[model samples]
Target: MARAILLRQLTLGPRSRLQLERKLRDRNVPMEVAAALLDRFEDVGLVDDAEFARMWVRGRGEAKSLGRSALRRELNEKGITGDLAEEALEELTPDAEEESARRLLARRVRPFDRTDPAARDKELRRLVGLLARKGHSPGSAFRLAAQVIDADSGDNVLEQRPY
Candidate 1:
């Protein structure tokens, strides 16, 4: 029964062993059965936490522009922890994160193009907040936001001297 349940779940999508164990628990499967089934699944490569973590990190990072911190939190929530999660996160380099942040900021600030200073400032704050929620540092968010806004405005606001 546990095997059937596990196979059915796997047919739907890849799941972490922890998630499968929880599902077994929720279904009232005996702990011993759950453990045996999980071990077998692992043996057969049907339940690989490391591969799941890697795929989760890649998919979420690309689809949501999530940073390392956010990705770590997500992996933890999905019952992926410790070295596997760290290894997956290591796949995302600092440059890749910064590039994702830049893309996020660029998309977010698109509507504010040609707006006045006050409105642009307001939008900038919102964009920074979005980045913050995605687990980016404030400094990185602000720098990226400024760079995107400057590029959109066709002026290097940071480089201009006030008359």
Candidate 2:
């Protein structure tokens, strides 16, 4: 019974043990049975939260251009915890976010015109909002968009302030 439930859930996608446990309990599976089944699944390599977290972060981050901060939040919400999440996040560092952002900008930067105030305002807001939804901070998203805009236009729309 426990295996049936677990397999059903996994057929949808990988799930952390905690998330599975919650769902199993909600379905009225015995706690002891659920725990034993989870242990068995782990011992046999059928369930691995660490691997799940890693793959989840990589796929979502790359596809959606999410930053580390956003990815971490997603991992936590999905029932991944502690060192597993941290290590997976660390492994994703070293330009993954920048690469994702570059890919996103490459696909969507053509229509924005930095010279027109109203058009620039609308474009900047749209870009910032889109990037923010993907987990980039407002400041980081703005800076990255500015980089793309300047590179394409030969003039910096967001000139750096004197430090």
Candidate 3:
């Protein structure tokens, strides 16, 4: 029954060893049995945390535009940590993260004209807050939001603040 449970979980989707262990535990599988089952799955190349983290980062980045900070937290929650999480996070380069942030802001932020200083400031704050909640650093969020707003207003101002 334990083996059947593990197989059924795996067939549904890839799982980290820890996730599988939790599943077995929830089903009242014995500790020793769960450990042995997980060990065998690892030995047979089924329960790989590294691969799981990689795929997770890739999928989430494409689908959700999650920043590295958010990805790290998610990986840690899934029992993918240390080298595996860091290695997977390395795929999202600084440039890629900035691009993702820009893309996210583009979708949500409307263009603000240079004539309306009050409205532009409000919009900037809103965009910065949105990016901050999504795990982007404050400096990058503010700068990126400013750049997008500037570009939209035809000023083409470059924000060169050190992040």
Candidate 4:
């Protein structure tokens, strides 16, 4: 019965072996039974934290525009181990981070009226807040926003802004 539930969970989504064990415990499945089921799943390649970590890094890095810091934190929260997390994070490059930041900035830049000082400040603040929540650092969020807002400029765009 516990194995059936475990199989169902796997069918729904990829799960780390540890996460499955924890959930099985919550369901009041006997420890021995849960361990046995997990072992069986591992043997059949149904539960693979390594593959899960890899896919997670790829998906979140591409879709959500998350950097290594954000990706590592999320994977750790999901029970990924340190070594595997490092390997996965190593696969992401600075270009990936920049691209994600660029995409986010393009969408967020319009809210600020570039012609008005106060409006620009307000928009920069709002954009900064949005990027911060998305897991970018202060320097990265502000710098990327500047680059996106002034793609053709030689001057520092943030300095020209009122705020």
Candidate 5:
């Protein structure tokens, strides 16, 4: 029954060992039975934390444009931590993260109006808050927001045109 439960859960989606253990425990599977079954699954390559982490990071990062911090928090919640999580996060390099942040900000920020200090300050705060809510550091959020705003300062018509 436990094996069938594990297999069914795997069929639904990839899961970390800890996730499976929690499910088994909920279903009243003995701890020893759960451990033995998990061991067999791992040995047979049916359960791999590293691979699950990689897939989760890639899928979530691409789909949501999430930062490393957000991804790490999600992984940690799912019982993926330490080296496994870091290895997965490494796939999202600093350059890629910056680009993603810039793209997101570019799409969101309004054209700058230096003529109005109140409006400009409000927009800057909004952009920085956007990135912060998405799990970026305050410094990184400000930098990226500023970079995108500066890049779209309308000095160059062809380059700054938004699609």
Candidate 6:
């Protein structure tokens, strides 16, 4: 029965071992039964935390434009931890993160012209908040926001300031 439940869950989507175990516990499956079933699943490659972490990181990073810190928090929430989580996060380079941040800012700030100080400042604050919530450092967010604004305006008018 435990095996059936686990297989049914996996048929829907991949699940971390911890998630699977929690599901089994929620269903009142005995601890020993859950352990044995999970061990079997692991042996058969049906429950692989590392691979789950990797896929999670890739999918979330691309879909959400999240940085390493955000990715780490997500993995932790999914019960991925320690070296496995770190290994998955390694797939996203700092350059890639920076580029994603720039793209996000560009798309969001396109409406506000950089020539207008009031509008630009308001837009910058909003963009920086977006980036910060996505786990980007304030400094990097400010620098990238300024770069995008300057490039769009065709003038290096926006100076990089500490956020």
Q: Show the colliding residue pairs in model 2.
A: none
Tens digit of per-residue lDDT, candidate 6, span 1-163: 9999999999999899989999999999999999988998999999999999999988888778898889999899889999999999999888778867766765676566556899878877887888999988889888777676666352332223222
The segments of candidate 1 whose C-alpha lies over 4 angstroms from its true place after superposition are 113-115, 153-163
lDDT for each residue of candidate 5 in 17-131, tens digit (9 for 90 to 100): 9999999999999999999999999999999999999999888876677889999999999899999999999998876776677767767877757678787778889999998
Candidate 3's clash total is 0
If scored against the real structure, what TM-score would every candidate get?
0.88, 0.83, 0.88, 0.85, 0.85, 0.88
Off by over 4 Å in 4: 152-163
Question: lDDT tens string, model 4, 41-93?
Answer: 88889888889999999999889988777899899988996899998887788
- Per-residue lDDT of candidate 1, residues 1-163 (tens digit): 8889999999999999989999999999999989988998899899999999999988888889998999999899889888989999999888788777776665666565455998779877888889999988889888777666766353333233222
lDDT of 1: 0.83
What would the per-residue lDDT of candidate 2 be over residues 52-151, giving only the tens digit for each residue? 9999888988878788888999999988878999988887764667667766865677565567888877776777777888778788789777666666
Task: Provide the clashing-pair count of each candidate structure.
Answer: 0, 0, 0, 0, 0, 0
Error of 3 at 139 (Å): 0.9
Candidate that scores best on lDDT: 5
What are the lDDT scores of the predictions, listed in order?
A: 0.83, 0.79, 0.84, 0.78, 0.85, 0.83
- Residue 147 lDDT (model 4): 63
Q: Judge candidate 5 at residue 68 and give its lDDT.
A: 90
Cα RMSD of all models vs. native, in order, equals: 5.2, 5.0, 3.9, 5.4, 3.4, 4.6
lDDT of 1 at 135: 86
- Per-residue error for 84 in candidate 3, Å, reads 1.7
